[model samples]
Target: MLRFIMQFVIILATLAAGNALSSVFHLPIPGSILGMFLLLLGLLTGVVKLRWVEGVANSHLRHMTLLFIPPVVGLLLNWGAVHIQLWKVLLVLSLSSLCILLGTGYSVELYEKRKRRRNG
Candidate 1:
């Protein structure tokens, strides 16, 4: 319980700091994204150890679907908006999924071939 609360506070503080920095610099990107980038940098630099908040963050992230349920339900309540963009959305989704699948498959194949060459 304490861990969860601490994680939530840390996330909020990071976001607030990111927002402050963005406002100070007049950056065009969103505060949350900037915060995420900052968090990533901190992790890479060992300034923020993964074990420090990994458990809490992972737990929250694992149940992130629950957080989206209300928004999804609200969207369903306004089904007309979805209908208007259905075709365009579907086309984009299909194309993006195809690209991801192809890229992942090619990457795995390349990795396997390289591994085999190294071993042989």
Candidate 2:
């Protein structure tokens, strides 16, 4: 219980720091995004141990879909505005998804080839 509380406090502190940075710089991006980037940097630099927050993060991930419900409902309720640019939105989404798929496929193939070369 104490560990969970400590991890939660650490996450909140990181978020608060990110919020402060966004507000100070008048950044267009949200504080949560900044906090996420900060957390990523910490992990990559080995400043933050994954074990410290992994449990809580995974618990949140299990209910991740629930988090999208509010935004989805809001979008549905304001469908009039969304419908006006529906085609444009669909076009962007389709193109982006296609790009992501192709990019991921190419990346995986390259990784596999490199691994095979190293092993052989």
Candidate 3:
């Protein structure tokens, strides 16, 4: 219990610090993203030992699905607004997914070609 509390506090503190920087600098990017970068930097630099945070992090991961409840609820509630234009939304989603799939495939092919050149 003590370890869980400490790890949770450490994660929240990092998030708060990131939010503070975002507010102070008026950066266009969101604060949570900043906090992620901060956490990554700390981990990479060995300033934050993974053991210190792993407990709480694992707990959050275990219950990650619960996090989507609010957004899913919102979408259901707003179904009427979206239902009118559902066809348009489906078209956009389909086209974008195809584009993304093709782009990812091309990227992987290029990466493999470069890797082969380097290795051989």
Candidate 4:
């Protein structure tokens, strides 16, 4: 329990620092995003060990779907506004999805090819 609390605190501190940096720099991006980048940098640099926050992160991931519920509900509530732009929204979403799918597929194929070449 104590370790969990400590890990949670670390996460919150990182977010707060990110928020502060965003505000201080008048950044267009959200502070939460900046905080995430900071956390990633820390992990990559080995300044923040994965074991320190892995449990808390996994717990959040487990319930991640629940986090989207509120935003989805909000969107549904404003469906009248969204309905007018439904076609445009659908087109953008479809195109973006396709782009992401193709990009990921190409990347995986490249990675596999490289791996196979190294092994052989």
Candidate 5:
């Protein structure tokens, strides 16, 4: 319980920092993207050790799919708006999926190449 609370506090603080930075720069991207980037930077820099919030963070990430529930529901409610842009939406979906697939494949190939180089 305490760990969960701490994790929540950390996430909230990161989000606040991200929002402040975005406002200062007048970024066109969403504050949430900025927050995620800040969190990734913290993780990479060891400023925020994974062990500090590992369990709670893992639990939250495990249930991250639930976060999309509200957005999906809102989309359903606003189906008419989407219907007008169905072709555009489909095009975006196709391109995004293709990008994700290509990125994953490239990352895997890179990882394998690096491993082989290190081992051999």
Candidate 6:
């Protein structure tokens, strides 16, 4: 449909602009991450309406696991290198995961407490 194409075009253009900016500025951040930040800015500023991309975005979220396929495959292919550092890799992953989980849980609890106070 025309709407679908238009939505994709807008999202892709934002990503392209972010990539261009990152390359031009020589930023260390990956272009894809920059593009996501750009997209978030656009959404917040009303430059990119949520309605325009909501459908496609939701669809992507629904099949989000597909996005990890390439990275997972690459890791598998390079498993020999990873195998040597498996313990170190797992330790780092475990610690990071624990930190993230704790951080998120505390953040949510804080938000809920504030919300309750505000409402009452």
Q: Which candidate is the best by lDDT?
A: 4
Q: Cα lDDT for residue 104, model 4?
A: 100
The model with the greater TM-score, 1 or 4, is 4
- lDDT at 96 for candidate 5? 100
Q: Rank the models by TM-score, top first.
A: 3, 4, 1, 6, 2, 5
Q: Give per-residue CA lDDT, model 4, range 1-120, as digits (tens).
A: 999999999999999999999999999999999999999999999999999999999998899999999999998999877646768889999999999999999999999999999999
Model 3 steric clash pairs: none
Clashing pairs in 1: none
- Model 6 residue runs over 4 Å out of place are 81-83, 99-120
TM-score of each: 0.70, 0.66, 0.87, 0.73, 0.65, 0.69
lDDT of predicted model 1: 0.87
**Whole-model alpha-carbon lDDT for candidate 3:** 0.93
* lDDT against the true structure, each candidate: 0.87, 0.93, 0.93, 0.96, 0.89, 0.88
Candidate 6 residues 1-120, lDDT tens each?
Answer: 788888878878878988898899999988878988998998899988899988877776899999899999998999877646668889999999999999999999999999999999
RMSD of 5: 4.4
lDDT of 4: 0.96
Task: Name the TM-score of candidate 3.
Answer: 0.87
Please give, for residues 26-107, the per-residue lDDT of candidate 3 as tens digits.
Answer: 9987888899899999999999999999889988999999999999999899987764577888999999999999999999
What shift in Å separates residue 61 of candidate 1 from its native position after superposition?
A: 0.7
Predicted candidate 2 versus true structure: per-residue lDDT over 48-115, tens digit per residue: 99999898888888999999999999989998786467688899999999999999999999999999
Q: Write the per-residue lDDT of candidate 1 for residues 69-109, one digit (tens) a residue.
A: 99989988988766566789899999999999999999999
Model 6 is weakest, by summed lDDT over 10 consecutive residues, at 79-88
**Candidate 1 wrongly placed segments (more than 4 Å):** 81-85, 103-120
